[model samples]
Target: MIAPLVSVVVPHYEAPHDLALLLTALELQTHPLDRLEVLVADDGSRDAPEPGPRPYAVRVLRQADEGFRAAAARNLGAASARGEVLCFLDADTVPEPGYVAAVVRAVTAGADLVVGRRRHADLSATAPDALRRWFGGQGPVPREFDEPTWLREAYERTADLADAGDDAYRFVISAVLSTTRRLFEDVGGFEEAFSAYGGEDWEFAHRCWLRGAEFRHVPDAVAWHDGPDFAGRTDDAQARRSRNVEGLTLARFVPGHANRGDQLVWSHPDVVVRLDDTGAAVADVVASVRSVLTGSDAGVWLRDGAALAVLEDPRVHRGEPPASVLGRARYRVDLERPVVLTGATLADLAEVAPVRVGEHLAVRRTRDLHRGGPDPAVLQVPGVTAEPAQDVDLQRRWGHEDHQRRPRFQRSLRTPFVATERPTAAP
Candidate 1:
């Protein structure tokens, strides 16, 4: 198979010394040199970054000097990228010779999102040539030192994140990551709103999660960050305050466990399933809501205002359309008809929810509801099981059977909206 071109986007501020070291390391990558394209995304530095002499292709992209805008800078790099896969790296992080190859292997194996292992070292005293030698294995492996133990444990426990939940994004880091340019642009690129030092990566990861992008941890693909981790950077009061603000901003934007502490104030709902009475008994609706609520902490949006007064449940939200209530939820389940849900349904949803992209998980559908008619599904109770509904038309889609289906579906989970056509390539 022909290897896909890999665009390595390096986010550089004013660190010319560190940037040069990183670029030198890139020149030694085990991946085919012809397939590698290096882009130095300069964040409005006073002096432009020079990638130094290189046999392979290298480009420098610069934007106006803005306060910490790594998110925007990375977005710019992605927009300029012509490769099928985009690999992101910080200016100070230098990768081992095999890093690029490992990233390519992961993507070719069906991983849309991949994070390489990042190890930390105090390269402040180390010479640039020595650093290059260490990365090339010509010198000692720069003193295998302390790294994020928690992060290492997470990948091991999750089996390289195959079993990770929607919340697993917390473990992903932008220091070393790779994904298809198509998927990156499809998810609306990184939110440029983040102008601070942190949280942009997590926010982007959360968005990718919503779109069903697969996450894989490539531990063998080592990249040595030039300095200590963020925690070791500074412990002053101002740094603490800035970190707190970044955390809160991330909570407000990213839903689910990531934003669990700010749930009441946050607009996004974690799990949303709409319930319309149609012709089903109010008792049936209540029972359905109960089953769902019991299974998970999903917010139930009631279509029948009259039923809202009767249910009197705190979890039941009724002020607006289900989509609006969901805000930016990654996925929303629509109950076309009222049917008693089993614990197994909730269990199945939890498992299938993370990997579902461009498709909805279907449980059974009624012929009447399939035709955009009212709920004709009969609820089964006690020992008897309800016969599965057979609606051949339902096979075509997952949501409202009556509503005209769109040619394209938006990755947005909140505020149910569909794009007429998939967004054009990232600009």
Candidate 2:
């Protein structure tokens, strides 16, 4: 088919160096410049960038300062876009030359949505920068290809594809997502409720799911992203994210990611609280399979001891332990926690932190704790009905390398690939 009109939508803020890299990459695209429309929405820059109208035919849309947000800007850009497909990018990301062309190729091949492969960027040696990188995988550019191409492209003709069942979330990340403009509007676009950052893509993806749009992972369409941004993650950011998280609870646990008792619930055995004065005490566990996480179960468990302390807190649930939380309590486990809970072997131990049900450890599995269903909790617990069992080695090596071996992706992601080749495109 004739090349579909394509528009690249960008929301840039503080990091100009990364913006420069993204611009440079796009400038080298093999696709014809005339068919491409690059619209950048400056989401309230602290200071306007000096580069004025120059060689390339890019349109810069400016707005008042509104706290480095991109969702509103995206809505505005999409409203005015003429391209058949709209692609979004962040400031600190660089797309390869063939990225756009690859996106179009995927769309024409019958995929409703296409996502760009993302690789972690390299970091400067400054101490602060290094710490930031470690927490968010914000280091130097990754040496490996962001993703493989064929895996992304073959999803088209879904029947031929071996298992579209696994890769069937029809929504891609706005960082480099493309779908027909028509479909985007039909779904009412992204929810402006998700202001500054975090989970907007997921919200929009869920919206698309509600509207019946299909998405695929396009690996060849690669870009380098500046790790995940926790810069704006203050109390307000978290509150907003939590609000969205709550609203999307049903969407999250059902359908695509149906409840599968993730790590948060399944790995309860790894965490135990012993409040005995001297082998003559009671216990309270901070984690549970499905009940609300009010400090009740744990509080009840803690009241029975002379001194209650935390045991295994690989991931801190709430900020620091509250001083007024019943008795004088302190953290127990040291170092980091393992990542045994979020794997595919979904487990459900009634209550991860077992409750004293009668004389026996009366435990009840969560409502949606099985695999192949909508899962509520982030960590996938193994859906075994048996009582929770502890792994001694897990307890021993709690923080030994911890989750360092796993790639630092806070969320799940798929790699996707391209359709046509343009001579001007660079690697």
Tell me the tens digit of each residue's lDDT in model 1 across 1-427: 7788999999999898888778888888888888999989999999988777786789999999979999999988988888999999999898889999999999888888999999988776666788777766688665555788889899989999878965677888998988889778867777787888888898888767656678899987889998777877777987889888787778667765546552263455556667665655665666666666664535677676455757777777663443234434654556655545443444345444332211222322211122243322332334323222222223343235336666574566667765488779978
Residue 243 in model 2: lDDT:
55
**What are the lDDT figures for the candidates, one per model?**
0.72, 0.50
Task: Kindly list the per-residue Cα lDDT of model 2 for residues 41-129, writing each as its tens digit.
Answer: 77778776543443346777767775645778788777777898988887666676778888888888776667777655453222333
lDDT of 1: 0.72
Best of the candidates, lDDT: 1
The list of candidate 1 runs beyond 4 A from truth reads 140-144, 236-239, 272-331, 335-427
